[model samples]
Target: MSEKRIIVTGASSGIGEAVARQAVARGWQVLAVARRAERLEALAAEIGCETFAADLTQEDAVAALAEAAATFRPTGLVQVAGGAKGAAPLGETTIEDWRWMFESNVIATKRVIDALLPLLRRSTAAPQQDGSASYAEIMVVTSIAATVSYQGGSGYNAAKSAEKQLIDVLRLELFGEPIRVMEVAPGMVWTEEFSLVRFGGDQAKADAVYKDVQDPLSADDVARVMTDILALPGHVSVDETIIKPVAQTHPWMVHKGPLVAKG
Candidate 1:
Protein backbone atom coordinates (compact mmCIF):
# COMPACT_ATOMS: atom_id res chain seq x y z
CA MET A 1 0.00 0.00 0.00
CA SER A 2 1.09 3.56 -0.66
CA GLU A 3 1.85 6.01 2.14
CA LYS A 4 -1.08 7.68 3.90
CA ARG A 5 -0.72 11.38 4.53
CA ILE A 6 -2.99 13.28 6.93
CA ILE A 7 -3.26 16.90 7.98
CA VAL A 8 -4.03 17.55 11.66
CA THR A 9 -5.07 21.06 12.68
CA GLY A 10 -4.48 22.59 16.14
CA ALA A 11 -1.47 20.31 16.50
CA SER A 12 0.43 22.51 18.94
CA SER A 13 -1.29 21.25 22.06
CA GLY A 14 -3.83 18.99 23.71
CA ILE A 15 -5.73 16.49 21.56
CA GLY A 16 -4.21 17.73 18.32
CA GLU A 17 -0.69 17.19 19.57
CA ALA A 18 -1.61 13.79 20.89
CA VAL A 19 -3.16 12.82 17.55
CA ALA A 20 0.02 13.76 15.76
CA ARG A 21 2.08 11.64 18.09
CA GLN A 22 -0.21 8.63 17.75
CA ALA A 23 -0.55 8.92 13.99
CA VAL A 24 3.23 8.96 13.69
CA ALA A 25 3.44 5.88 15.88
CA ARG A 26 1.16 4.09 13.39
CA GLY A 27 3.68 4.84 10.60
CA TRP A 28 1.48 7.41 8.90
CA GLN A 29 2.77 10.65 7.42
CA VAL A 30 1.43 13.73 9.19
CA LEU A 31 1.43 17.45 8.54
CA ALA A 32 0.69 19.07 11.87
CA VAL A 33 -0.86 22.57 11.73
CA ALA A 34 -1.18 25.15 14.49
CA ARG A 35 -0.31 28.76 15.35
CA ARG A 36 2.68 28.00 17.57
CA ALA A 37 5.78 27.54 15.48
CA GLU A 38 8.00 26.74 18.45
CA ARG A 39 5.72 24.01 19.74
CA LEU A 40 5.26 22.59 16.24
CA GLU A 41 9.03 22.52 15.85
CA ALA A 42 9.41 20.56 19.05
CA LEU A 43 6.71 18.07 18.03
CA ALA A 44 8.32 17.64 14.63
CA ALA A 45 11.72 17.06 16.18
CA GLU A 46 10.38 14.51 18.59
CA ILE A 47 8.01 12.62 16.28
CA GLY A 48 9.54 13.14 12.82
CA CYS A 49 6.41 14.62 11.28
CA GLU A 50 6.14 17.81 9.21
CA THR A 51 4.67 20.90 10.88
CA PHE A 52 3.02 24.08 9.65
CA ALA A 53 2.32 27.12 11.82
CA ALA A 54 -0.81 28.96 10.76
CA ASP A 55 -3.76 30.46 12.56
CA LEU A 56 -6.83 28.87 10.99
CA THR A 57 -8.83 32.03 11.76
CA GLN A 58 -6.68 34.14 9.47
CA GLU A 59 -7.44 34.12 5.74
CA ASP A 60 -3.89 34.62 4.58
CA ALA A 61 -2.58 32.12 7.05
CA VAL A 62 -5.03 29.45 5.95
CA ALA A 63 -4.31 30.14 2.31
CA ALA A 64 -0.64 29.74 2.98
CA LEU A 65 -1.29 26.60 4.96
CA ALA A 66 -3.28 25.11 2.10
CA GLU A 67 -0.50 25.82 -0.34
CA ALA A 68 2.03 24.15 1.90
CA ALA A 69 -0.29 21.23 2.59
CA ALA A 70 -0.79 20.64 -1.13
CA THR A 71 2.85 19.69 -1.35
CA PHE A 72 2.23 17.07 1.28
CA ARG A 73 -0.84 15.81 -0.63
CA PRO A 74 -2.85 14.85 2.39
CA THR A 75 -5.22 11.90 2.11
CA GLY A 76 -7.18 13.01 5.20
CA LEU A 77 -7.87 16.05 7.37
CA VAL A 78 -8.48 16.01 11.13
CA GLN A 79 -9.78 19.36 12.42
CA VAL A 80 -9.29 19.84 16.17
CA ALA A 81 -8.40 23.51 16.31
CA GLY A 82 -11.59 25.12 17.65
CA GLY A 83 -12.28 25.85 21.34
CA ALA A 84 -14.62 27.72 23.69
CA LYS A 85 -13.58 31.14 24.84
CA GLY A 86 -15.86 31.87 27.77
CA ALA A 87 -18.50 30.19 29.89
CA ALA A 88 -21.04 32.80 30.91
CA PRO A 89 -24.81 32.89 31.15
CA LEU A 90 -26.51 33.62 27.86
CA GLY A 91 -27.40 37.19 28.74
CA GLU A 92 -24.14 37.82 30.52
CA THR A 93 -21.87 36.44 27.79
CA THR A 94 -19.95 39.00 25.79
CA ILE A 95 -20.86 39.30 22.12
CA GLU A 96 -17.15 39.19 21.35
CA ASP A 97 -16.87 35.74 22.85
CA TRP A 98 -19.67 34.36 20.69
CA ARG A 99 -18.19 35.93 17.57
CA TRP A 100 -14.77 34.48 18.27
CA MET A 101 -16.25 31.04 18.77
CA PHE A 102 -18.07 31.19 15.46
CA GLU A 103 -15.05 32.49 13.62
CA SER A 104 -12.70 29.92 15.08
CA ASN A 105 -15.00 26.94 14.85
CA VAL A 106 -17.43 27.52 12.01
CA ILE A 107 -15.85 29.99 9.61
CA ALA A 108 -12.34 28.66 10.04
CA THR A 109 -13.51 25.13 9.26
CA LYS A 110 -15.21 26.33 6.10
CA ARG A 111 -12.09 28.17 5.00
CA VAL A 112 -9.85 25.17 5.46
CA ILE A 113 -12.26 22.91 3.62
CA ASP A 114 -12.57 25.27 0.68
CA ALA A 115 -8.83 25.79 0.50
CA LEU A 116 -7.88 22.12 0.65
CA LEU A 117 -10.60 20.42 -1.34
CA PRO A 118 -8.62 20.15 -4.51
CA LEU A 119 -5.59 18.68 -2.79
CA LEU A 120 -7.72 16.14 -0.94
CA ARG A 121 -9.27 15.11 -4.22
CA ARG A 122 -5.85 14.65 -5.75
CA SER A 123 -4.81 12.33 -2.94
CA THR A 124 -7.53 9.73 -3.33
CA ALA A 125 -6.18 6.20 -3.04
CA ALA A 126 -6.53 3.24 -5.34
CA PRO A 127 -9.66 1.12 -5.63
CA GLN A 128 -10.11 -1.85 -3.30
CA GLN A 129 -11.43 -5.35 -4.12
CA ASP A 130 -14.98 -4.13 -3.55
CA GLY A 131 -14.58 -1.78 -6.50
CA SER A 132 -14.94 1.19 -4.16
CA ALA A 133 -11.98 3.53 -4.14
CA SER A 134 -10.48 4.78 -0.90
CA TYR A 135 -11.11 8.49 -1.14
CA ALA A 136 -9.79 11.27 1.04
CA GLU A 137 -11.41 11.81 4.43
CA ILE A 138 -12.39 14.87 6.48
CA MET A 139 -12.82 14.39 10.21
CA VAL A 140 -14.01 17.20 12.49
CA VAL A 141 -13.82 17.39 16.28
CA THR A 142 -17.01 18.86 17.66
CA SER A 143 -18.19 18.92 21.30
CA ILE A 144 -20.91 17.17 23.27
CA ALA A 145 -22.13 20.68 24.02
CA ALA A 146 -23.14 20.89 20.39
CA THR A 147 -25.99 18.50 21.01
CA VAL A 148 -26.59 19.01 24.73
CA SER A 149 -27.52 22.40 26.13
CA TYR A 150 -26.26 23.61 29.49
CA GLN A 151 -26.07 26.83 31.50
CA GLY A 152 -23.10 29.10 30.74
CA GLY A 153 -22.49 27.10 27.58
CA SER A 154 -24.82 28.84 25.18
CA GLY A 155 -22.12 30.57 23.16
CA TYR A 156 -19.98 27.49 22.71
CA ASN A 157 -23.02 25.35 22.16
CA ALA A 158 -24.18 27.63 19.38
CA ALA A 159 -20.78 27.59 17.70
CA LYS A 160 -20.21 23.84 17.82
CA SER A 161 -23.79 23.14 16.79
CA ALA A 162 -23.28 25.31 13.78
CA GLU A 163 -20.07 23.48 13.02
CA LYS A 164 -21.90 20.18 13.22
CA GLN A 165 -24.48 21.46 10.81
CA LEU A 166 -21.73 22.54 8.47
CA ILE A 167 -20.23 19.07 8.49
CA ASP A 168 -23.60 17.49 7.87
CA VAL A 169 -24.24 19.71 4.89
CA LEU A 170 -20.75 19.12 3.62
CA ARG A 171 -21.35 15.40 3.62
CA LEU A 172 -24.55 15.90 1.70
CA GLU A 173 -22.91 18.20 -0.81
CA LEU A 174 -20.06 15.77 -1.29
CA PHE A 175 -22.40 12.84 -1.78
CA GLY A 176 -21.70 10.59 -4.80
CA GLU A 177 -18.07 11.58 -4.39
CA PRO A 178 -15.46 9.29 -2.94
CA ILE A 179 -14.50 11.66 -0.14
CA ARG A 180 -15.56 10.79 3.41
CA VAL A 181 -16.83 13.34 5.91
CA MET A 182 -16.96 12.36 9.59
CA GLU A 183 -17.52 14.05 12.94
CA VAL A 184 -16.56 13.16 16.50
CA ALA A 185 -18.07 14.80 19.59
CA PRO A 186 -16.26 14.46 22.89
CA GLY A 187 -17.43 15.31 26.42
CA MET A 188 -15.44 16.42 29.49
CA VAL A 189 -11.95 16.14 28.07
CA TRP A 190 -9.61 17.40 30.80
CA THR A 191 -6.87 19.08 28.85
CA GLU A 192 -4.35 21.45 30.39
CA GLU A 193 -5.11 24.49 28.23
CA PHE A 194 -8.76 23.91 27.31
CA SER A 195 -10.49 24.84 30.56
CA LEU A 196 -7.65 27.19 31.42
CA VAL A 197 -8.14 29.13 28.22
CA ARG A 198 -11.91 29.00 28.59
CA PHE A 199 -11.66 30.38 32.11
CA GLY A 200 -9.18 33.05 31.08
CA GLY A 201 -6.14 31.44 32.70
CA ASP A 202 -7.71 31.05 36.15
CA GLN A 203 -5.98 27.96 37.47
CA ALA A 204 -8.36 27.57 40.37
CA LYS A 205 -11.41 27.80 38.15
CA ALA A 206 -9.93 25.29 35.75
CA ASP A 207 -8.92 22.98 38.53
CA ALA A 208 -12.41 23.14 39.99
CA VAL A 209 -13.90 21.81 36.76
CA TYR A 210 -12.33 18.38 37.25
CA LYS A 211 -12.06 18.43 41.03
CA ASP A 212 -12.87 14.99 42.44
CA VAL A 213 -13.90 13.62 39.08
CA GLN A 214 -12.52 10.12 38.72
CA ASP A 215 -10.62 9.73 35.43
CA PRO A 216 -11.93 12.47 33.22
CA LEU A 217 -11.08 11.88 29.55
CA SER A 218 -7.56 12.87 28.66
CA ALA A 219 -6.06 14.06 25.37
CA ASP A 220 -4.66 10.62 24.63
CA ASP A 221 -8.01 9.01 25.17
CA VAL A 222 -9.66 11.17 22.54
CA ALA A 223 -6.69 10.92 20.22
CA ARG A 224 -6.82 7.15 20.30
CA VAL A 225 -10.44 7.18 19.21
CA MET A 226 -9.61 9.56 16.36
CA THR A 227 -6.70 7.47 15.12
CA ASP A 228 -8.73 4.31 15.30
CA ILE A 229 -11.43 5.86 13.18
CA LEU A 230 -8.84 6.88 10.60
CA ALA A 231 -7.48 3.36 10.52
CA LEU A 232 -10.76 1.82 9.41
CA PRO A 233 -11.15 0.59 5.85
CA GLY A 234 -11.47 3.51 3.46
CA HIS A 235 -14.74 2.16 2.15
CA VAL A 236 -16.25 2.21 5.62
CA SER A 237 -17.26 5.57 7.10
CA VAL A 238 -18.10 6.26 10.73
CA ASP A 239 -20.30 9.27 10.17
CA GLU A 240 -20.71 10.54 13.74
CA THR A 241 -19.22 9.30 17.00
CA ILE A 242 -19.78 10.55 20.56
CA ILE A 243 -17.11 9.86 23.18
CA LYS A 244 -17.41 10.56 26.90
CA PRO A 245 -15.73 9.29 30.01
CA VAL A 246 -17.62 6.95 32.30
CA ALA A 247 -17.89 9.76 34.85
CA GLN A 248 -19.54 12.09 32.36
CA THR A 249 -23.07 11.31 31.33
CA HIS A 250 -23.76 14.76 29.95
CA PRO A 251 -22.06 18.10 29.58
CA TRP A 252 -23.57 19.36 32.82
CA MET A 253 -23.60 16.02 34.64
CA VAL A 254 -20.47 14.31 35.87
CA HIS A 255 -19.93 11.81 38.67
CA LYS A 256 -17.28 13.34 40.91
CA GLY A 257 -16.19 10.30 42.84
CA PRO A 258 -15.22 6.68 42.19
CA LEU A 259 -17.85 4.38 40.83
CA VAL A 260 -19.42 1.87 43.20
CA ALA A 261 -22.10 -0.79 42.89
CA LYS A 262 -25.60 0.31 43.70
CA GLY A 263 -27.04 -1.05 46.95
Candidate 2:
Protein backbone atom coordinates (compact mmCIF):
# COMPACT_ATOMS: atom_id res chain seq x y z
CA MET A 1 0.00 0.00 0.00
CA SER A 2 2.94 2.37 0.59
CA GLU A 3 4.47 4.19 -2.28
CA LYS A 4 7.81 3.61 -0.57
CA ARG A 5 9.30 0.15 0.04
CA ILE A 6 9.95 -1.15 3.56
CA ILE A 7 11.26 -4.32 5.24
CA VAL A 8 10.17 -5.60 8.66
CA THR A 9 12.06 -8.33 10.51
CA GLY A 10 10.31 -10.56 13.04
CA ALA A 11 7.18 -9.94 11.06
CA SER A 12 5.37 -12.92 12.55
CA SER A 13 4.27 -11.26 15.78
CA GLY A 14 4.85 -8.71 18.51
CA ILE A 15 6.07 -5.24 17.67
CA GLY A 16 7.38 -6.28 14.26
CA GLU A 17 3.96 -7.53 13.21
CA ALA A 18 2.41 -4.38 14.59
CA VAL A 19 4.80 -2.14 12.68
CA ALA A 20 4.20 -3.96 9.41
CA ARG A 21 0.45 -3.75 9.75
CA GLN A 22 0.73 -0.04 10.49
CA ALA A 23 3.00 0.57 7.52
CA VAL A 24 0.63 -1.22 5.18
CA ALA A 25 -2.22 0.88 6.44
CA ARG A 26 -0.30 4.00 5.43
CA GLY A 27 0.09 2.66 1.88
CA TRP A 28 3.69 1.49 2.18
CA GLN A 29 4.94 -1.56 0.30
CA VAL A 30 5.88 -3.95 3.09
CA LEU A 31 8.28 -6.89 3.03
CA ALA A 32 7.42 -8.94 6.10
CA VAL A 33 10.28 -11.24 7.16
CA ALA A 34 10.23 -13.87 9.88
CA ARG A 35 10.97 -17.48 10.81
CA ARG A 36 7.30 -18.33 10.88
CA ALA A 37 6.17 -18.68 7.30
CA GLU A 38 2.57 -19.41 8.21
CA ARG A 39 2.19 -16.23 10.21
CA LEU A 40 4.05 -14.15 7.69
CA GLU A 41 1.92 -15.52 4.87
CA ALA A 42 -1.25 -14.75 6.74
CA LEU A 43 -0.07 -11.22 7.54
CA ALA A 44 1.02 -10.60 3.99
CA ALA A 45 -2.33 -11.78 2.72
CA GLU A 46 -4.26 -9.71 5.19
CA ILE A 47 -2.27 -6.55 4.48
CA GLY A 48 -1.61 -7.07 0.78
CA CYS A 49 2.11 -7.21 1.45
CA GLU A 50 5.13 -9.35 0.53
CA THR A 51 6.80 -11.93 2.78
CA PHE A 52 10.08 -13.84 3.22
CA ALA A 53 10.52 -16.92 5.41
CA ALA A 54 13.94 -17.32 7.02
CA ASP A 55 14.90 -18.41 10.51
CA LEU A 56 17.43 -15.53 10.65
CA THR A 57 19.38 -17.52 13.23
CA GLN A 58 21.13 -19.49 10.54
CA GLU A 59 24.10 -17.80 8.89
CA ASP A 60 22.67 -18.45 5.46
CA ALA A 61 19.32 -17.04 6.53
CA VAL A 62 20.91 -13.95 8.03
CA ALA A 63 22.76 -13.41 4.81
CA ALA A 64 19.50 -13.76 2.96
CA LEU A 65 17.78 -11.34 5.31
CA ALA A 66 20.35 -8.61 4.66
CA GLU A 67 20.46 -9.10 0.92
CA ALA A 68 16.73 -9.49 0.67
CA ALA A 69 16.43 -5.73 1.14
CA ALA A 70 18.45 -5.19 -1.99
CA THR A 71 15.90 -7.02 -4.09
CA PHE A 72 13.04 -4.97 -2.76
CA ARG A 73 14.87 -1.63 -2.56
CA PRO A 74 13.11 -0.86 0.68
CA THR A 75 13.08 2.66 2.06
CA GLY A 76 12.36 1.46 5.58
CA LEU A 77 13.65 -1.33 7.84
CA VAL A 78 12.15 -2.66 11.09
CA GLN A 79 13.94 -5.34 13.10
CA VAL A 80 11.59 -6.92 15.64
CA ALA A 81 12.21 -10.65 15.70
CA GLY A 82 13.95 -11.55 18.96
CA GLY A 83 13.37 -13.74 22.05
CA ALA A 84 14.63 -15.00 25.38
CA LYS A 85 15.52 -18.68 24.94
CA GLY A 86 14.87 -19.77 28.52
CA ALA A 87 14.02 -18.15 31.82
CA ALA A 88 15.92 -20.47 34.13
CA PRO A 89 17.07 -18.93 37.37
CA LEU A 90 20.48 -17.24 37.08
CA GLY A 91 22.57 -20.14 38.35
CA GLU A 92 20.67 -22.65 36.24
CA THR A 93 21.01 -20.58 33.04
CA THR A 94 23.23 -22.34 30.51
CA ILE A 95 25.62 -20.95 27.94
CA GLU A 96 23.63 -22.63 25.17
CA ASP A 97 20.47 -20.74 26.01
CA TRP A 98 22.31 -17.45 26.36
CA ARG A 99 23.90 -18.03 22.99
CA TRP A 100 20.47 -18.60 21.51
CA MET A 101 19.32 -15.22 22.74
CA PHE A 102 22.43 -13.41 21.51
CA GLU A 103 22.73 -15.15 18.18
CA SER A 104 19.09 -14.78 17.18
CA ASN A 105 18.75 -11.19 18.34
CA VAL A 106 22.18 -9.57 18.08
CA ILE A 107 24.25 -11.60 15.64
CA ALA A 108 21.45 -12.13 13.16
CA THR A 109 20.56 -8.42 13.25
CA LYS A 110 24.15 -7.42 12.55
CA ARG A 111 24.44 -9.87 9.68
CA VAL A 112 21.22 -8.71 8.08
CA ILE A 113 22.21 -5.06 8.37
CA ASP A 114 25.64 -5.80 7.01
CA ALA A 115 24.05 -7.34 3.95
CA LEU A 116 21.29 -4.75 3.64
CA LEU A 117 23.35 -1.66 4.31
CA PRO A 118 24.37 -1.23 0.73
CA LEU A 119 20.76 -1.21 -0.41
CA LEU A 120 19.63 1.06 2.39
CA ARG A 121 22.51 3.33 1.56
CA ARG A 122 21.49 3.38 -2.06
CA SER A 123 18.01 4.46 -1.18
CA THR A 124 19.35 7.43 0.76
CA ALA A 125 22.42 8.37 -1.27
CA ALA A 126 21.22 11.88 -1.99
CA PRO A 127 19.32 13.40 0.90
CA GLN A 128 15.81 13.93 -0.33
CA GLN A 129 14.95 17.60 -0.47
CA ASP A 130 13.05 16.69 -3.59
CA GLY A 131 9.74 14.88 -3.38
CA SER A 132 11.42 11.61 -4.44
CA ALA A 133 13.22 9.74 -1.68
CA SER A 134 16.86 8.82 -2.22
CA TYR A 135 17.66 7.29 1.14
CA ALA A 136 15.94 4.91 3.57
CA GLU A 137 15.44 4.70 7.32
CA ILE A 138 15.26 1.81 9.79
CA MET A 139 13.41 1.23 13.06
CA VAL A 140 14.56 -1.43 15.49
CA VAL A 141 12.38 -2.66 18.38
CA THR A 142 14.45 -3.08 21.51
CA SER A 143 13.21 -3.99 24.99
CA ILE A 144 13.19 -2.10 28.24
CA ALA A 145 15.02 -5.24 29.31
CA ALA A 146 18.08 -4.00 27.45
CA THR A 147 18.52 -1.24 29.97
CA VAL A 148 17.29 -3.33 32.89
CA SER A 149 16.33 -6.95 33.40
CA TYR A 150 14.02 -9.27 35.26
CA GLN A 151 15.62 -11.80 37.63
CA GLY A 152 15.87 -14.48 34.93
CA GLY A 153 16.76 -12.23 31.99
CA SER A 154 20.51 -11.87 32.48
CA GLY A 155 21.27 -13.23 29.02
CA TYR A 156 18.46 -11.57 27.06
CA ASN A 157 19.21 -8.22 28.62
CA ALA A 158 22.86 -8.37 27.73
CA ALA A 159 22.08 -9.25 24.12
CA LYS A 160 19.70 -6.33 23.63
CA SER A 161 22.10 -3.94 25.32
CA ALA A 162 24.82 -5.04 22.96
CA GLU A 163 22.53 -4.50 19.97
CA LYS A 164 21.56 -1.06 21.20
CA GLN A 165 25.21 -0.07 21.52
CA LEU A 166 25.96 -1.28 18.02
CA ILE A 167 23.24 0.94 16.63
CA ASP A 168 24.48 3.89 18.61
CA VAL A 169 27.86 3.45 16.98
CA LEU A 170 26.17 3.13 13.60
CA ARG A 171 24.30 6.40 14.11
CA LEU A 172 27.49 8.29 14.87
CA GLU A 173 29.17 6.77 11.85
CA LEU A 174 26.22 7.49 9.58
CA PHE A 175 25.52 11.02 10.73
CA GLY A 176 26.29 12.62 7.38
CA GLU A 177 24.34 10.05 5.37
CA PRO A 178 20.60 9.96 4.85
CA ILE A 179 20.28 6.33 5.96
CA ARG A 180 18.74 6.77 9.39
CA VAL A 181 18.55 4.24 12.22
CA MET A 182 16.21 4.33 15.21
CA GLU A 183 15.33 2.08 18.14
CA VAL A 184 12.01 1.79 19.99
CA ALA A 185 11.80 0.10 23.38
CA PRO A 186 8.44 -0.95 24.70
CA GLY A 187 8.04 -2.00 28.35
CA MET A 188 4.97 -4.20 28.01
CA VAL A 189 2.45 -4.39 25.22
CA TRP A 190 -0.28 -7.01 24.94
CA THR A 191 0.97 -8.78 21.85
CA GLU A 192 -1.09 -11.86 22.83
CA GLU A 193 1.89 -13.84 21.63
CA PHE A 194 4.26 -12.13 24.10
CA SER A 195 3.75 -14.51 27.02
CA LEU A 196 3.13 -17.46 24.72
CA VAL A 197 6.46 -16.77 23.06
CA ARG A 198 8.12 -15.92 26.35
CA PHE A 199 6.77 -18.87 28.34
CA GLY A 200 6.65 -21.21 25.37
CA GLY A 201 2.96 -22.15 25.18
CA ASP A 202 2.03 -22.29 28.87
CA GLN A 203 -1.38 -20.73 28.58
CA ALA A 204 -2.10 -20.37 32.28
CA LYS A 205 1.29 -18.94 33.16
CA ALA A 206 1.29 -16.61 30.18
CA ASP A 207 -2.12 -15.32 31.12
CA ALA A 208 -0.85 -14.57 34.60
CA VAL A 209 1.81 -12.15 33.30
CA TYR A 210 -0.82 -9.49 32.70
CA LYS A 211 -3.42 -10.52 35.25
CA ASP A 212 -2.56 -7.54 37.42
CA VAL A 213 -2.02 -4.86 34.76
CA GLN A 214 -5.51 -4.22 33.43
CA ASP A 215 -4.58 -1.59 30.85
CA PRO A 216 -1.74 -3.22 28.97
CA LEU A 217 -0.73 -1.51 25.75
CA SER A 218 -2.41 -3.29 22.89
CA ALA A 219 -0.36 -4.15 19.80
CA ASP A 220 -2.38 -1.46 18.06
CA ASP A 221 -1.14 1.13 20.53
CA VAL A 222 2.48 0.43 19.74
CA ALA A 223 1.76 0.21 16.02
CA ARG A 224 0.16 3.63 16.10
CA VAL A 225 3.10 5.28 17.84
CA MET A 226 5.70 3.61 15.64
CA THR A 227 3.72 4.62 12.60
CA ASP A 228 3.69 8.21 13.80
CA ILE A 229 7.44 8.21 14.35
CA LEU A 230 8.09 6.86 10.86
CA ALA A 231 5.69 9.31 9.27
CA LEU A 232 7.75 12.21 10.58
CA PRO A 233 9.50 14.34 7.99
CA GLY A 234 12.87 12.93 6.92
CA HIS A 235 14.81 15.90 8.23
CA VAL A 236 14.16 14.70 11.74
CA SER A 237 15.74 11.43 12.86
CA VAL A 238 14.60 9.86 16.10
CA ASP A 239 17.46 7.97 17.72
CA GLU A 240 15.36 5.98 20.16
CA THR A 241 12.14 6.21 22.09
CA ILE A 242 11.47 4.21 25.26
CA ILE A 243 7.83 3.52 26.14
CA LYS A 244 5.99 1.61 28.88
CA PRO A 245 2.37 1.03 29.84
CA VAL A 246 1.07 2.99 32.82
CA ALA A 247 0.46 -0.27 34.69
CA GLN A 248 4.18 -1.07 34.34
CA THR A 249 6.46 1.67 35.64
CA HIS A 250 10.11 0.58 35.43
CA PRO A 251 12.37 -2.41 35.56
CA TRP A 252 12.23 -2.63 39.34
CA MET A 253 8.75 -1.19 39.89
CA VAL A 254 5.16 -2.25 39.24
CA HIS A 255 2.06 -0.14 39.91
CA LYS A 256 -0.81 -2.60 39.90
CA GLY A 257 -2.94 -0.79 42.46
CA PRO A 258 -6.17 -0.96 40.45
CA LEU A 259 -7.45 0.24 37.08
CA VAL A 260 -10.20 2.17 38.78
CA ALA A 261 -7.63 3.88 41.03
CA LYS A 262 -5.23 4.59 38.10
CA GLY A 263 -5.20 8.08 36.64
Candidate achieving the largest lDDT: 1
Q: Put down candidate 1 lDDT per residue, 43-151, tens digits, no spaces.
A: 9999999999999999999999988997898999999999998888898899998999999999999999999888887777466446656678999999999899999
After TM-score superposition, what is the CA distance of residue 141 in candidate 1 from its true location, in Å?
0.0
Local accuracy of candidate 2 as per-residue lDDT tens digits, 1-263:
12478888888887788888989899888899988899988997788989999987787886776666667887777888787665668788889878888888788778777777777777765545555556578778878988887887788789889989878888888888877789888887777676776676888877776777768888778878888988887657888898888778776566664846536
Model 2, residue 252: displacement in angstroms? Answer: 3.3
lDDT of 1: 0.92
Q: Residue 98's C-alpha lDDT in candidate 1?
A: 91
In model 1, state the lDDT of residue 99.
90
- Give lDDT per model, in order: 0.92, 0.79
Per-residue lDDT, model 1, residue 118, is 85
lDDT measured at residue 217 in model 2 versus the true structure, 0 to 100: 85
Candidate 1 clashes between residue pairs 3 or more apart in a chain or in different chains = none
